[model samples]
Target: MTDAVRATPAARLRGIGHEFMEFFRDLTQRSPARFAILIYLSLILVFTGLFSLPFAAEDGRVTPFADAFFTAVSTICVTGLATVDMATHWSPFGHVLVFIGVQIGALGVLTLASILGLVISRRLGLRAKLIAAGDTNPLRTHGGPVNEGQTVQLGQIGGLLATVALSTLVIEAIIAVLLYPGLLIAGVEWHVALWEAPYYAAMSFTNTGFTPNPEGLVPFEHNYYFLTILMAGVFLGSIGFPVIYALRQHLFSVRKWSLHVKLTLITTIALFFAGGVVFLILEYDNLLTLGTQDAWDTTFQAFFLSAMTRSGGFAILDVGELNGSSLLVGCMLMFVGGGSASTAGGIKVTTLAVIALAVWSEAKGRQSNQVFGRRIPSDVLRVALSVVAWGATIVALSTIVITQLTKADLGRVLFDVISGFATVGLSTGLTAELPDPGIYVMAITIIMGRVGTVTLAAAVAASSRSQLYSLPVERPIVG
Candidate 1:
């Protein structure tokens, strides 16, 4: 009896730990969307604490909670928007935190979790595969008949994870190698260039536009080769990992590419040129922007701005100085964001592609949405529609609240809101000036944008039901 009494406290502690493990395991299997969100929030809290440390700042003072929290959200979300001076506010320790935060963030919440699980167990379990698959394809998050053809298959989840890790390392290494010479030519010290090269590489590839230097991109503003390298890195990062995996297997064979790959590439290329043309036309004569440059410089800068607007976050031109029409164009581009499952955010280019295809089919009086020789089911269209609706609602509410708080111009407010919502990191000189309240709101916007509308919706859903019976259908008049 005395021994039992002495052991009771330890026994209870063990029991509690076991129960917590069981609950976590269940959460991973039952609702990975929620699990992913939980992990992401936990990361934000941890990073926020780290950022708030006295040594995190250059002056050895404790950073304010608001800036630290906002920076944490921005880093984890891979959103470049900063409430504080990203270049000058943090100490070397803080900069290291940003570096590590973005690398983890770029791996994505679910993927990072799965990688951790893989390391612990030394195998990829079925549940772990499903969780990682959820990152690549939202349909895997809930119970339903999923079109596995639309995304990475269960068998490929391991390869996808490998690709995620290997590709990030390889691409960033190549980009850094390419950037080192440019930084040297631009007069940076060799030691500084060594660090800055990879820093810029990660920032570009992750689509988090935080610059390591106080001057941002001003020093390399007219360096076409440097700017072009950044643009290439952004393009690779924004085009979703599934697309990359597919392309890796079928790079030379265009016929073997999946429909997702087809749409992503086509729409991304289309938007790249189209946005550049629009910006070129709108900002051609604005003295504060591209207007001061010669014809060649102006043309290249317009395209560079277009690339950055699509979630690259690196800006050679001052985003605030563009024409109002140009700002609206930026809003549209930022709203579309990058491809799904990529480090970039927004509604995703694939979502835009699906909606555009559905519209095209409807206009043509077709019974189904067909693209690249495959039929897109109604459910996919419905989810695409839901993403658009939710995304728009989030942006609208954020813009309204921030507008009321800041009393800023609608154009600037809308641009920054959309930028936050899309995780584009482009700012109209407003994000840095936001008050604490506005900073929190914008942080929330970045979270929503990064977690994605579909995944966020799934995370909050009470439960997924099979619905064994069909209800009576009624058609309603619509626009």
Candidate 2:
């Protein structure tokens, strides 16, 4: 301190810079969940500023800060609900800007930061691993307490990130190839076709509902090839990158899959097929939906809609035309969402599975939370319940706020609200017409959904004190 006081101005400035860097590292190292959340907020702000630029909009149109902010939120959150026409409202520069946001969002907020870290430092510090831990599920899976502070190794982190980035690019590239010729044959200009293919690929693979075309997916409604490619992308993307890596490493054997993988694969597939069957039964006679198509086409469209309901957001049939029962089903599916640590959002399939398992255990009077020949820890169960509880709270609060603002029907408001909270991007015709307050509310919902309930809870719980003494057990009356 004495030396610093005696030092020149340059030395003082250096000392200040060093102190700042250390503080930044400490902040990051302490709670990666909060750090990741910070990155998301910062990125959203940057994209909003970029969208606010006059050059980002159509030649004659000026996008208001609110609209620009909404679009930026949707893109960065990878929620496709749009306040305006993507193709007509945004200039190519704007589209590119949105695309960049989508790409980064789809890769994940922590993941993008880790990538940047690798570029700058050629290595990830312990802080980066803490953030990546949010995606990897180390604490529960490795049989540790909720407060376990284990960190993944640098090599494992590198491989995990490499698989995520490489797989995303490779899959998107392949889908783009499949979509290219169709775009050309559809009379799209060569330049536009070139962009649309990649755009659709990114959107689909990220499970984002955004479409590059003005008509949305309607023009390609009957195009099985187009829909198939998109469906495949969404399905694969919704399967977490961790699962994908496991599949890549051990596709030929069932033994290698972790319990988490097993549950996710089983639940995701069951949901997909069950959703298809339910829709087919419900919409079999509705002329506005599948009833208008020929028998074979109707079945395909029903299944396609089912796939999209898994947070993919690309709809061949108008969601608004579906029967009330189908709408209820859509809301349920959107709320359940895709896999853990996936670009797809919601409470996640694993959380749902855990809840169901817990229910079953209670019903059977089992002493342990058991599934897949293993005992799921108490911590996992607690986390799952917390996520579900928080998720429900968010959806309920958003529904009330949005309905109050828009004066929309309860059901329509519920659909849009849940869609925003789950980041499903599906709408019941209310998104484009939502008032400013409604839009702002939906934007906040998307952020919560994208950040995830568990992550948020963890960030808030960081300052909590550990119990040095256990409290006496007490039982409350059951429902």
Candidate 3:
């Protein structure tokens, strides 16, 4: 009788735990978007606690909650915006935390959530595949007749996950190896270079941009080889994993590339050159920026700045010293950001490509947006539009709130706000000066931006109720 009574509580506890896990598993299958957000939020909170510890800081004192929380968000979001000095503020422990946090963040939240779900469920079933597909294929979220050619097939989800993991490990390892010699040439100690190499590789590839040294990029400003490696890492990361996977499978054969791959590469390259030229024109004579350098240095720096503005966040120039026109240009580049499912954030390169193609089609009076011999669907375009609308709204609202809180200039506020919203770490010296309230608001913006516009919208909508019958279409007045 005594043994039976003692075992009852244990059995009851096990039952409760089982029920809780089942509920979580169901949530993952039903709403992967929310599951992702939940995971990201939980991660941020956990990191926040870690940073708040005394040992996390260089000084043997517990860090302020606000600063810790912001850093946590920035690190996990891979945004790199920091209220505290990233270089000198933390101990080796904290830096390691940042490194791990970014790797987790670099794994797309949806992908990570799906991975967790897979582990918990112990199998990649049809529903789990749909969850995984939500990451590689955003089209899966809006249930309809999906064109499988446009997305990673459900069967390929396992391969996609493998690609994501193998690519991240292999690419970052290669980047680290490339950076090791550069760090050595830059006069870093052999032992220090060991750590700095992988650290720089992670920061660049993740587009997190947190420098470990107190001097930041000032020492390596003249080291074009090192800078080029950084840029290369950023480019690979910003291009998105799906694009990488496609290229890996069909590198020599350009004909096999998907529309997403073609558009991402073409648009990314176009923006790279366009932004470089524009920056050269606007800041070529500005003494505070590129003017002080010689012609060669100036031109190189201009391109570097252009690359950095594409959500790389590794700044060779003082972003705050740039001309007003250049800042505006920077804002536009940052807002567009990198490709979808990339470590880099923003509306995404695909979004920009679609919108630009749509605009071009409209100008040509085409009935459908067509590109690279493939017809762009209306649904994809609609999602692109929604992404832009939500992104703009987030940026606008963040700018307004932060501006009011800081009483800073509109231009600076807008620049930093977009930087945070786009998860670009480049700051106009304003992000560091923000008050606590502004920090919290920026944190929210970073989370929203990193979570993604479509995912965020879906999370809010919760359950999608497909209409049984279509409503009669009514045209509103055209703009």
Candidate 1: list runs displaced more than 4 Å: 2-12, 117-128, 137-151
In order, candidate lDDTs are: 0.87, 0.83, 0.89
Instruction: Estimate candidate 3's alpha-carbon lDDT, on a 0 to 1 scale.
Output: 0.89
- Any runs in candidate 3 off by more than 4 Å, and if so which? 1-7, 125-128, 138-150
Decreasing TM-score order of the candidates: 3, 1, 2
For 1-479, candidate 3 gives per-residue lDDT tens digits of 67657778879899899999898888777777788899999999999999999999999799999999999999999998999999999999999999999999999887888788788766665665775776664545443564666678888887898899889999999999999999999999999999999999999999999999999999999998999999999999999988898889889988877777888899899999999999999998999988888999999999999998888888878888988899999999999999888999999988899889999999999999898777777888899999999899999999999988988999999999999988999999998899999999999999999999888887788676768898889999998
lDDT of 1 by residue, 34-117 (tens): 877888999999999999999999889999999999999999989999988888989999999999999889987677767655
Q: Report the poorest 10 consecutive residues by lDDT, candidate 2.
A: 145-154
Candidate 1 — which pairs collide?
Answer: none
Best by the TM-score measure: 3
> Candidates 1 and 2: which is better by lDDT?
1
Best by lDDT: 3
Candidate numbers, best lDDT first, in rank order = 3, 1, 2
Worst lDDT run of 10 residues, candidate 1, spans: 138-147
C-alpha displacement of 72 in model 1, angstroms? 0.5
Q: Give TM per candidate.
A: 0.95, 0.93, 0.96
RMSD of 3: 1.9
